[model samples]
Each structure stands twice: as structure tokens, then as C-alpha cells.
Target: MDTIKKYLESMFEHLPKTLEVMRAKDELYSMMEDKYNELISEGKKENEAIGIVISEFGNLDELAEGLGLSKVLDDLVSSDRRYVSRQEADDYVDAVVSRRFMLSLGILLCILSPAGPILLDSIATATGLNLFTGIGVAFLFLCAAVGVGFIVFSNYITKSWSFLNKQPCYIDDETIDYLKSEKEECQTGNGMLLAVGIMLCIVSVIPVIVLDAALNVPIISDGVGPSMMFTLAAVGVFLIVFSSGRNKAYKKLLSLNKKVFAREILQQFADAPDNGPEKSVKIERVTGEVVESDYKDASYSSYDKPEQSSDSTEKKVKNFIKVMVKDYWKSVLCIYIIWSFFTFSWGSSWVIWPLAAILRKPIEQYFLGGKH
Candidate 1:
């Protein structure tokens, strides 16, 4: 039944959120539900019934045009099964804005990185001060710190917004199409920006070369090289930051995250529903008292031994370990090797093993929604 709802939601995702569209979706859900119930009554298994219903009623183009949402039919036909809600759209926009601001600040700092060194050199030349003084070294460190800080802070800001990686609660077709279009457009823009940035970086050094050879300006020649290099680095940083932000935004809209919905339909073991009425089971307590408790129908029988439960648990743990290694063994190996190379700290490197244990659930959930 939940599968039916998810399918209907995916079909209607591209449509406008209008009253007419809502009416169409409701009518469609009712129709699918009726078909599902009829199939179930015929003794068909639940999975087979769902498959039949979906195949029969999955086409939605004509329904969309009839509902006056023909404008989105092209997208519906082309889009994969993905959806996003209005709130999610708004949240993505907010995240992009915040990320853009941090990236811009980082780029500005990179651009200014050479200024301190150039200014200090100019002051030394003018005042006849020694260039290798303690003050000069301190100024150099300050400029380097600014550049490093900008890079680190920008990365931190971007990582802080990683919560957006979670699957959205609701999604629709229109949202999916919009994101696809935006991703395409952003990719094109990034390419253009990269070309322009490369051209500017190449041209930046021309001024210094021309000043030294064609005009013989020693002061300007000395300062321009550092300035040009800083400018080039800034351009590279900007391109990286801007392109990454766009990619993240598009990924969110695409719902690349795995999502799972599980529904348990309890079937009565008795031949007649009335004979079972409200099902209950009897359990003998350690105190030797027999108690009756409601028991939902499940595949496992009440007569199963306790060892069966233990075996199931053991199998799940083995599966979890297998998946963890399959997904992250390379990363774990790299971390260990890098730590060992720099600090020769094999003992501390072992900490990553425990860290992997802590992260196991999240990594599994990311790829499999925590299902084995």
C-alpha cells in the first residue's frame, strides 16, 4: 500500500501544487487502492498485487494534461523517479546563499594574500630598513595565515551544511526538473568561468614582463610577480568553491541519498478472520506464571526456538561488517597509512578502528538506509 502511494507521488511530482492537481492525485490514489484491494481479495500475494496495479495505472501524461498541468508533461516524461517539496526547495536556496557568501570571502582573502609582502618590501626600500628583520618575517607569516585561514574557514562552512545530505521528507516532479535544469545551467556557467579565470591568470604576468623588458621599471617588476601569483591562486580557489557549491545544490535536489520505506502487513494464521479475532499468545514467565499478550502476525512462528533468534542476530552482525568493509576499506587503509607515514604512530592509528565502529551505522544508513 505504501509502495502505491510512493508511486503515485512520483508520477504527480512534476505537476503544479494546485487544487485541481490535488484532486487528481486523490482520485488516482483511491483508484489504485481499490484495484489493490480487489487483487488481494483474490488471494494474490501483496507484492504481486502491487506490481499489477502499478503497471495498469502508471501512465500519467494524459491525466496530467486533463488536469491542466500539460506544461510539465515534458519534464514528467524525461525525469527519473524523484521528488522534492517546497520546504526542501527553500532550504536548498538558503544553503546555497550561505555557501556562496563564505566562498566569496575566501576568494577575497586569497586575492589579498600578496599585499602584505609587497607593502613590507616597498616600506623597506623607502625607509632603508633591512628586509630580513623580525618584523618582515612576522608580516610574511601574517599573509600566509590569512590565505590558509580563508581556505580552512571556507571548507568548515561548507562542511557545516552537510546536514542537507539527508533525504528530503517530501519531493515532487517539478522540483526534480527544476534542479536538473539548474544543474545543467550551473555546469555551463562553471565552464565559462573557468575559461575566463585561466585567461586572466595567464594575462596577469604579462604586465610585469612588459614593465621589466619594454619599460625597465624595477620596482613594479619586483612586486608584480608576487601579485600575479596571488591573483592566479585566488582565481583557482574561486572556481573550486563556486563549482563545488553548485554541485552540492544539485545533488540535494536529485535526492541521491538512499531512502527506504518498510511496511509490515500482518496476516492472520487462522483460516477465518473472525476465528482469530484479536490474536494473542501465551508465554510462561520465569516466575512460572502464564500470561496472554497480543501478538502481531509475522513470518516467524511462536514455536521457533530461542537459538533461531540468536542465529538471526549473528547473521545481521556479519552482514553489517561485510558491508562496512566493502564500502570503506580503502579509506580506512589510507588513513592508517597516512598517519603511520607522518607520525609513525601505529598505536594512535589504531584509533581509526574504533572510529570506524562509531561511524558504521551512519555509513550503512547512507548507502542502504540501514537495511542489510
Candidate 2:
């Protein structure tokens, strides 16, 4: 009974140490189990099989070294309280400010160029503005003013907006411990930048719309409204493209592609303090297993085999497609309703509004619910 407890404890001691090198303990456990089953199939008894499993756990000192545990431990012990780093605060500020400005700019642009143009053309043709030189001149002048407003506002907003210097983040002991143990490093790359941009774009839309309507010249209302909406659409599309590029860049940056990193981590572990009971236990286990054979017999291998993962990834893909399809459907219905209303006034146009009213509810919810 004592031996079993000792063996079990012995087997798990490396887990805590390995936690410092791993992304997730569960992934390590799964990897270990797979290795253990491979060994058992080679005719080793259960205890020997377990021993073999413990023996091949790679270099702990190297892993700890890679994770920078020595620095982490020293920092934790030395700290009187959790203090936020200047860099982290700076990151937060940058993120917030970028987001706010992108939003504000997007809104301003949308409003200044509102989607009233297409409807204006429709109204102009129906009302005979083309034949009337006076009315056509007025319409042209209104468009020119809206175009100038969009350019000036967009430039001003983009230039004036800047990220702040201080931002909020976790500075707790547990957070530091987890980050240190996992050896997971974060790089605030283009994705965060892009995220801030997207959020700002979405939020700015409402404000842009309100401002455009409030500033409308009575006769130029229809033309200005559509112009603003179209301008906003263009900005949103541009931001989406920029955000996508940033994400791609970030992914490429995190692809640690060097073998030297493994050895470096091992060295870091070897230098870490050996004072704590947990640290000592992990060191002993790694030291013991540094020379184990790496073979796994066929019979034991089956026990550690990965289960057939449910098609969850497929389900997620389908769900995304479903959402997109629903959104496309709603947008189509909305456009149809609007076009019908503008073309056919009152009796026939009135029916279009009721139909739009029915379709608009679900479509509005879809867009509003999904917006960042």
C-alpha cells in the first residue's frame, strides 16, 4: 500500500514540473498515457510499464529553463503585492484608443456620405429633376458638399485618434503563476490592432448615422442619407480587410521553428531554485527518467490511442455557414423591401413597409446581436 502511494506520487511529481513547459496539463497527460500504453504492449508488467512511462518524460531542467521558472519564482517571492507592468498598461491603452478612434471615424464617414444617393437618383428620375436644370444643379451641389464633408471628417478623425498610455490587465499572483508555469508568451501583434479596428468600425456606425441625419439640409436629406450609409459600408469593408491581414501576420509570428529552444528551456529549468518541495520532487523525477528507453511495444500502444474525436469542427463550420446564409437572406429581404417602398408610394409602397416590418425584426436582431 505504501509502495503504491509512493509510486503514484512519484508518477505524478513530474506533472507539476512539466506544467511549467506545457500549454495544458491535459495535453501532457494524454501524451504520457499514449506513451505508457505503447510500453505495456512490449510485455512489460503494469508497474514496469508505469516505470517506463515515468522514465521517458524528457528533460525537466530543460523544460523549466525554457519556461523561465527561476525568474518567475524570484519575482513572485520578491513581490509585496501584484503590480501591473508598464508595458501591459501601455498595451491596454493602445488597444482601447485604437478601437475608439476607428469606431468614431467609421461613424463620422458613414454619416457624412449617408446611403441617400441611390434613392436620390430614383427620386430625381421619378420627379423629373434631370429635365429641370435648376433642380439638377441643386442636387449636384448637395452631392459635392457631402463628398467634401466625408473626406475632411475622415482625415480629421483618423489623425486625432490615438491609443491611450494606461490600460487594465491581470496582475494577480495566480495569473503570474499560471503564465510562468505555462511558459506561454503573448505578443500584441496585428490581430489585437485589427480587433480594435473592427470594434470601432461597428460602434462608430451608429454615431455616424445620427450625426448625418441631424446635420441634414431639408431638401438634400435623401441624397445625403444614402451617401453616408454607402461610405460607412466602404469603411467597414476596408477595416475587415485590414483586420484579416493582421491576424494572418500574428499567426505567422508565433510559429516557433527552432530546435535550440528546447535545449534553452532545459537549461533554464536546471538553473531554477530547488528550495520548494514541489520543485524538488519534479527535479528528482526528471533526473531519474533522463536515461529511459524510448521503445513502445505494439500491444501497449493501443491503450494510448486517441479516441475518434467527434466531428465538432465540422459542426462549427456548418453553424458558421448557417449564420452567414441567414444573414444573406435577411439582407436580401431588407433591400427588396426598401427598393419597393421607394418606387411605389403609399398604397403599394405602404404594403412594402408592413412586409419590411415583418422581415426587419429578425434581420435587425441578427445584425444587432452579432455586432461587436
Predictions in order: lDDT: 0.54, 0.41
For candidate 2, what is the lDDT? Answer: 0.41
- Give the lowest summed-lDDT range of ten residues in model 1: 259-268
RMSD of 2: 20.9
What local lDDT does model 1 show for residue 139? 59
TM, every model: 0.44, 0.25
Tell me the tens digit of each residue's lDDT in model 2 across 1-372: 233334434433322234453443344456567777787688778887766655655443433444455554454345332234334434433444454345334333322322344445645655767544444445544643553343344333323222111211123333334334322333344456445545544553454457557875533444444444445444543344334332322222222111112223334454675343454345334432221111112112344467755577976776665565444423333453455447732112212222332354465455443211
In the range 1-372, model 1's lDDT, one tens digit per residue, is: 999998888776655455767887898889889999999999999999999999988888656666555655664455343454666675665667566556445444534444456645655665678663446457545644564455445545556445444432335555666777877877777777656644554455465567667654444655555455455545643553454456556665564322211110111222225333233331112111111211222322454446455558778987766665554533454464467459944223434433453464577665554432
True-structure RMSD for candidate 1: 17.3
Q: Which residue segments of model 1 deviate by more than 4 Å?
A: 1-84, 100-104, 107-112, 126-139, 155-170, 257-372
Candidate 2 steric clashes: 27
lDDT of 2 at 49: 71
